[model samples]
Target: MKLSDAAVKKAKPEAKPYKLADGDGMYIEVMPSGSKYWRLKYRYAGKEKRLALGVYPEVSLKDARERRDAARKLIANGTDPGEAKQAQKREGKIAAANTFEAVAREWVENRSNDWTAGHKALTLRTLEQDAFPSIGRRPIAEISSSEVLATVRAIEKRGALEIAGRVLQRCSAVFRYAIATDRCKNNPAFKMSEALKSPTRSHYNTIEKGGFPKLLRDIDGYQGSPMTTYILQLMALTFTRTGELVNAEWKEIDLDRAEWLIPAERMKMRRPHLVPLSVQAVAVFREAAKLSGDRVHVFPNRNDPSQPASNAIILRALGRMGYTGKMTGHGFRSAASTMLNENKSKWGIHRDTIELQLAHVEKNASRAAYNFAEYLDERRTMMQQWADHLDKLKAGAEVVKLRA
Candidate 1:
């Protein structure tokens, strides 16, 4: 029987502090202290359950009726609202306890001290941009292979093939990090290499990228960040990794001496590298230093002053100028290795010095192990000439090299 509001009003204050005479599952319980709380009565799994509907006035009789209808629909769908609420609470607790984002942060802090600040920032940026939106809130142990594959495939759809590849590799490393700590037993991201295979036809080749001087001409016109332009130019001159170049500290440089000392930890071979700075290389730093303020890194992220630009910053800048098909950050090495070796004498640069400057590991382990001679003096001279070669290109002069 549905009792009218007027009837309840006539009997409520004197008899029961509050009661739902006409409502299905709504009532106000007035405590001994004279405060009222709304309660919802429902039957679930063959038992009656009382669900709190919040405090009265806050959860008024009209608002309580709306909530009652929502709960009843859950029951009609075979879901117990009370049990679902408890399960949801458990999910929230577990998500915070074991989320993929949480474990990855742990991995970055714990397992990645060897990574330079530049690399660390880049790694985190990739995760935050490409991976987090989809699965960051999921428990680390619950991120399925399908979820990861979907994320990378989405990057591929945007034509970031190389970035997709790197994301796959880093995602695999994070899951491995989780496994090492026993946070997860199975790597859903493991052995899924074929999923990333690109179908788009590439019309350009990396090995032959340097022979195309027109491409270099195109790069000269790129109006992207001047820092990125200078960066690519330096990569060509030094053949250093993008991370190393951007993270170059002022202390490591000697302008009067024409040298840049990259510490052993920063080198790929885990040995200290002496870059004999060319005239142009020295000039590049002086300009970069002024533009970067006193920030420790040569190329700090514009959006974030704490660290260098992400590894993709230069590459993406290249992409904006249509060089994505023809070149990459690592491609500068191939260009230098090819052009330097091909035109050594033509530019007054020496072949032995160019090879030594490249630190091209002598293939034989025995030879490399025995080799302590880093050809410091000759490489220094040759690096200056190499920088001059680029200037010649800018000036349209023919390359002239010394007789070997």
Candidate 2:
């Protein structure tokens, strides 16, 4: 018999259980405890089975009837509706577990051992601050390229074009990991970089080839802080980054061995780099040691001996010497590389030895690992020659012409 809404609602619960059947297999089971549950009964493959549709009035009369008809159709086609419903539940659970944030974090954790501490922290902070807020909860496989693009564009809105590019790169890495693990079909973040605003690349100002001599002379004549003067001398002789040189500790240097072993954590590439100090560099270091006394940093701040000198000091010193926009502390490296590479024939130094001294990472991984100290002896010779060449330039030696 068909059941009406009023009949189902007005029906009283008795001492025993009772049911009011709507039709087919749909029925409302009334319990003595005042509970009503929707149930379905059907036969398939010569067997009878029952399925719980839901509880009412949450399920309601109309929804229960629709479910009953749908289940009946499945039975007519020789399929079990109960099993299909269970499969759907399982899939929902899997998708919930494979969310973009979940997979991205897992990928990071799995690769943490291969990354430096700073690299790990920076990568996680970028994802947390930038990408995770909007789309992290969505399933990885369902994330569209447009959604990722919107996340990146948010960063661009703040005028951080370079950071936007980096965030997009991290997102792409996560998508690639998901694809490799079968959690996603494709890397949607891939090639989406074209949608981002490109940043304007600016090269550091540097002295011209013929201007090196004049630049060195000005630096020598400049009447700045004595510490600043010694710093300028070492900056040119070593050609190391301003940050690396300024933050140097006395313990990291070996004056007897004429070597400066910069630890991995301080280096930009996150690898230990060997700086073979020349006689000139050692003399400058000796002066720094006398000036710094027993302070922790070789170039401790004049006001605060506990901290290293500010990196801005180098640029300011150059500016004070009237070299503003003509040279930078970093320009020393470019100047050194240019002269060394051009004079390689006369200098009799291999390009690889010069590159190692510059602390540039090798593109080939296997070769880099095995040859980290491949040409230490050769680098020592090259470092001395480089220092001597600087002295000649400072003395106004005639410029040598390159062979055509």
Top of the candidates by lDDT:
2
Which segments of candidate 2 are over 4 A away from where they belong? Answer: 1-138, 150-164, 180-183, 192-200, 207-211, 322-329, 398-404
Which runs in model 1 stand beyond 4 Å of their true positions? 1-95, 116-118, 157-159, 199-235, 241-251, 262-273, 279-331, 337-404
Task: Estimate candidate 1's alpha-carbon lDDT, on a 0 to 1 scale.
Answer: 0.73
**CA lDDT of every candidate:** 0.73, 0.87
Taking all chains together, each candidate's TM-score versus the true structure is 0.53, 0.65
Residue 197 of model 2, lDDT score: 91
Q: What's the residue-level lDDT of 93 in candidate 1?
A: 85
* Local accuracy of candidate 2 as per-residue lDDT tens digits, 261-332: 988777776778889899888988998889886999999997888999999999999999888998898898
**Collision count for each candidate, in order:** 7, 0
**Model 2 deviation from the true structure expressed as Cα RMSD, one decimal place:** 7.4
Q: What is the C-alpha RMSD of each candidate to the true structure, in Å?
A: 9.1, 7.4
lDDT of 1 by residue, 241-358 (tens): 7778877776777777878888867765545678888877777777877888588777878898777777787678768877676677777777777777787777666665776677
